[model samples]
Target chain A: MSSRVRKIRENAYVMNTIGIAVFIALWWLAVEARLISPLFVASPLAVVQVLFTQTASLAQNTYITLVTLVESFLVAAAIGILAGAVTGAFDVADWVISPILDLLRSVPNVAWVPLAIIWFGIGIESQIFVSAFSAFFPIFTNTYVGFKSVRPSFIRAGYNLGASDRDVFFRIRLPASLGQVFPGLKLGIQNGMAGLIAIEFLDSTSGLGFMMGEASDFFKANIVIMDMLMIGLLGFALTMTLVLAEKRFLGWQRRTS
Target chain B: MAQGNSVLEVKNLTHVYTDSRSHVETEVIDNVSLSFQEGKFVCVLGPSGCGKTTMLNIIAGFIRPTSGSVVFEGKEVKSPSPERAMVFQDYALFPWLTVSGNIQFGLMMKNTPAKVREAKVTEYLEMMGMKGFEHKYPFELSGGMKQRVGLARALAVEPKMLLLDEPFGSLDAQTRRTMQRELFRIMAQAKKTSIFVTHSIDEALFLSDRLIVMSARPTRVLIDIELKSAKPRQRSDKEYSEVYEKVDKVITAEVSKSIE
Candidate 1:
């Protein structure tokens, strides 16, 4: 809250606006100068016009993609939390299962696209599986670390207070691990989104990714550009909502920043 | 089995462990044996890294001594139980819980009636001098206040004894002084048999009825002296300085030897 810090932050916002304005100005100039064909990269004005005019279709596709991303992410998160807690709570469990998880997580999720398509027949199940696969790692790894690194004193305190094994996990372990868990969930969301878009691009689909793929095939650069812009906006909005929800749940945690 | 008025006893306790990384064996606690009666404040003083914490943890039943036993109320201590509660140096107040919630935690775990829990929490809140701030989170409180809450939480459970590990070690000198005074007053009110561990000789002299001093790693009792001083004992008193210098001299020598 120092005056200097406040001034610097205000200038940062000003610079961000300037950066956007400059990029758009350059884009318009490039199109006007005919330096590149608009068929490949549409002008900002054309993309915005398309974005506004195709609002209904855009909303429908966006909703479909959003639902698939969210459902998969939720399932992945639930499984990750349970499995992570098990690994974190018991060293034997970690030794037995962690290597397999690490091995599976190491592969690129997009590589599963062909298998998913073959197995689920280009249906929503394949999209969801891909999304879940992308989202699972961050949550799992972070939750495991979170459970492992919980201050020993808190666990001691719980037991000293006569908490049973069950009470320790549900009452002390889970709630205490949540601070570490939130960052993992946040990372998982971003990864799931990237995976969702990549998978959508792979085959027959109804979401924004499919629309973009179809448009690009016919060289509808304006529509493709608008769809890409919509994807970025959706990611931003989802993350912001997550950050707000994170604050509501984990605001009590001591934040270094 | 009833040792008359001997509420707790530590008999021939010894512990050894290897450094996980170094893989070299070391004895952290060497055949330590000591005990205290009910309602007496015992302060443990030792050289740095003297395994005072390890000993306290054993007595709390958080860890078992490699050999020997801690008997409380005629039973060998098997595990951590509500009968013995600890006040930790770092406060250890759950970050996600409010002041009242943290204080009432033991009671909730024990399945005390909500009505009784509410009453006991309120009582301890006032006892620890942290009234009217029940909803504040641990992050909101200062070091001294948070330690007070930690103490209140421990006391709220009505544990038979209290174990404190450097509870005021994190506070500034000024806050430490104030908390020491407050803690002394609160201990007087509860009159629970308590063992406090500290690096400060002055803290030991102020709070303890019996001072137990220990040496560095593989620690053994070097000096066990009864500090017969009345409550609210003056820091500048003749006897106070006498005991302080005696304990300080013994610990200082051990500290030098341990370094070598």
Candidate 2:
């Protein structure tokens, strides 16, 4: 088992190296041919220089963006999961709340920026609200579906074993539904981050999106490219961390499936 | 028939399911009456779609009958209780839980204390010959192993009765035979009143003290044969063949009639 794991790790490293090398080669060729104007898309070398030159400020901006994104995601996830679980478990709750959730989800996150600014003002709160709104729907829908779709046999088994309604929900239904909802949660967080960045680009005065907007306005294409790279890198890192956490926490689920 | 020792009594039970789209009321079980004696192994045998499973569900109180009642130990069953546990054909072991966890689930539901629940789980695990597989999840185990876990889970509760819905129907022939033997040994030891539903003729004859044969859809009891064999019944005995032939003839006729 150890040897197999080691081989898999080595293969992953090699694949990453091959991917980066190919990407760098393509970037170099594009720059040499001037296929992408320097005004719009800076050269790889220029972007790297900008990365070092603005490292401190860039890191600070990235930190701000990360904090806001994480806060929004955690809040949305907590609310969505709790509401979805309650609604899914109770028929009256589902009847009362599902339509309202659907209405909220219908309005796009970017469209909420104007109202969010009026309500929470142009700050982290507004951005967080936008992110939370963006994330809420998928997680809610997935969790509701997951809870509702649990097999009748399982519920019956629990009941026959003398489980109370509450016991059934907590012990059997919640854990079973997690198998379906976790993927949705991951997707919701990713989309929420994207939505946060979009809102920031349109309205915010700080964070990675604001940094990129400022660089674009000044025609500092390299700095703009660096910010975009930072966004991608951060998103990738966060998603990987979540996936790792899922694998660790849900090892029993993996073993079962 | 044993007198005044009935563990389960189903009287004139009927169940009708109404389709939402078609607005058609289909009667699954029609005016069925049966009584199971305490500590007896009774097998309900019938063809597919004969509502054998519906009968089991009604007895388990998983579904309400459209008419009549299922009385358990002189009390009418309104809802599922731990006194009656079911071992489903699919082995319905919670996919998220390990084998030990599944077995302990019933004890937990009954609010059995931690130490007692652990002891019961351990005992049943050993009885099921699944001692080392307690930590393995349902998906990691074979179909036979999963069934054993289901059986252990059911047994751990020490219910007054057990309901088995074709427990070995999904297994291969060899595994099915092995499981059947194992089931017999477990039932003999526990002496729990059991209602087993199966379509297999030999299986019913081999395992049951009394076999109730039913007609296909809109099912009703066609024949109830009492096997008077002593303990450790010999499959090749003349009396066993006689009982088998009697049930086989009745079921074959009923099946053909239903098809026509």
Candidate 3:
């Protein structure tokens, strides 16, 4: 490697730390200088202090949100992939079902929150329904397009190699479509988190979104900021998990590219 | 060379492709008739988009010709069957399957016993010179190696005939030469009836026992001649040049005719 490139690579982590430290120092300076109102923004110190003080509440609320997120995401993935495979594989089904899905997907997912609340009440059931509804569209659309986009030559090869129609579908089409499905699932998870937080803000008595809202009402800026940071952390962890899973399953794709 | 009985017969095949959206009809194949004897290698050379692939697909039973029939061993070919395996230009090996799995796919589909499938896969792996690469996926291999696996996957099925559609069209010149030599060696040993379609005159000359040159779109056989040249024929040889000149003249004239 060139000296410049080697120097950058070696100091990459140190540079990241320095950058973060500088950002935090600037924020502290802004608080101390009173350029920002104390009522609006929390000082870096105060947010960290709240992190230790409110650990129990943060843990409990995060656990609740995490559970709802997983449950709703699983539900979305199962139905989305199944429906997508069916609709994609059969022309008649695609013709009949895609228009309906398009219409349903057009109505903003939050629009269903009211109906969900009425159906399942202000609880985990309602939360999951709303979140899963939001998550479903991306996963379904990606999987459908994935299946639809299978190379004709591959299908012909499958049949030419003595495979039955069903064999060709299960063996060739399903696995080939998975490369596209991973991106959809990633987007689905991000959207699911959005829906979960939205529903929690509106109706839930538990979860991080509810806790953040309650803190905001009481003017606990530090607690609210800490909760926001926690949400960011959770989203990062979940996305990392998905990326790792994708690597494990689609190793062939990575090697090729 | 003691060629066997007629294995595949194409009688007056014509195909018209219709675009459902634009409602435009394209007559791709124009009443072409041909036949293949058992254990003979036939190579088809044609202008680009002259419906060579359409003819191959029709013979492979992947598509029905608009008119006429394709009969193989006295049976009408209505749909794709394992008996006629094809090697594609793109090397259409399953991306998800390892090399071994790809070669064994046909056996698995046939519901051959596990032991037999394993044996067949191993046999083909050796034959294709891909012995140690069984665990590797298609994407991990070079283009030449991928086509080797593709050939293994096709030949493992013990098909009655092999159909290759520009199998080396995508390869580098050096790799194409290597693959062509490998293919010739393997086919000679197996002595299976084979039909190959390509755009290269030299490739057709180098590989085929019989050669068919096709006309432009709405394609028909312009010439079909048995190559009486000896095996491993050199391009520089007097006989090779004589036949090459004859075939090259026909192709050049047809290409200019299309331009006009």
lDDT of 2 at A27: 84
Greater lDDT among 2 and 3 belongs to 3
DockQ of predicted candidate 3: 0.74
Candidate 2 residue lDDT tens string, B179-221: 9889988887788889999999888888888989988878888
lDDT of each: 0.89, 0.88, 0.91
TM-score of candidate 1's A chain against the true A chain: 0.92
Q: Assign candidate 1 its CAPRI class.
A: medium
Best by TM-score: 3
DockQ of 1: 0.72
Residue A117, model 1: Cα distance from true site in angstroms: 1.9
Question: Can you give the TM-score per candidate against the true fold?
Answer: 0.95, 0.95, 0.96
Off by over 4 Å in 1: A1-14, A52-57, A254-257, B1-4
Error of 3 at A117 (Å): 1.1
Of candidates 3 and 1, the better by lDDT? 3
For residues A169-254, write the lDDT of model 3, one tens digit per residue: 79998999999899999898888999999999888899999998999899999999998998888888888999999999898786
lDDT: worst 10-residue window of model 3 chain A: A248-257
lDDT per residue for candidate 1 within B149-212, as digits (tens), equals: 9999899898999999999999999999999999988987898889999999999898898899
Judged by DockQ, which candidate is best?
A: 3
Cα misplacement distance, residue B95 of candidate 2 (Å): 2.4
Q: Mind listing the fnat for each candidate?
A: 0.87, 0.85, 0.83
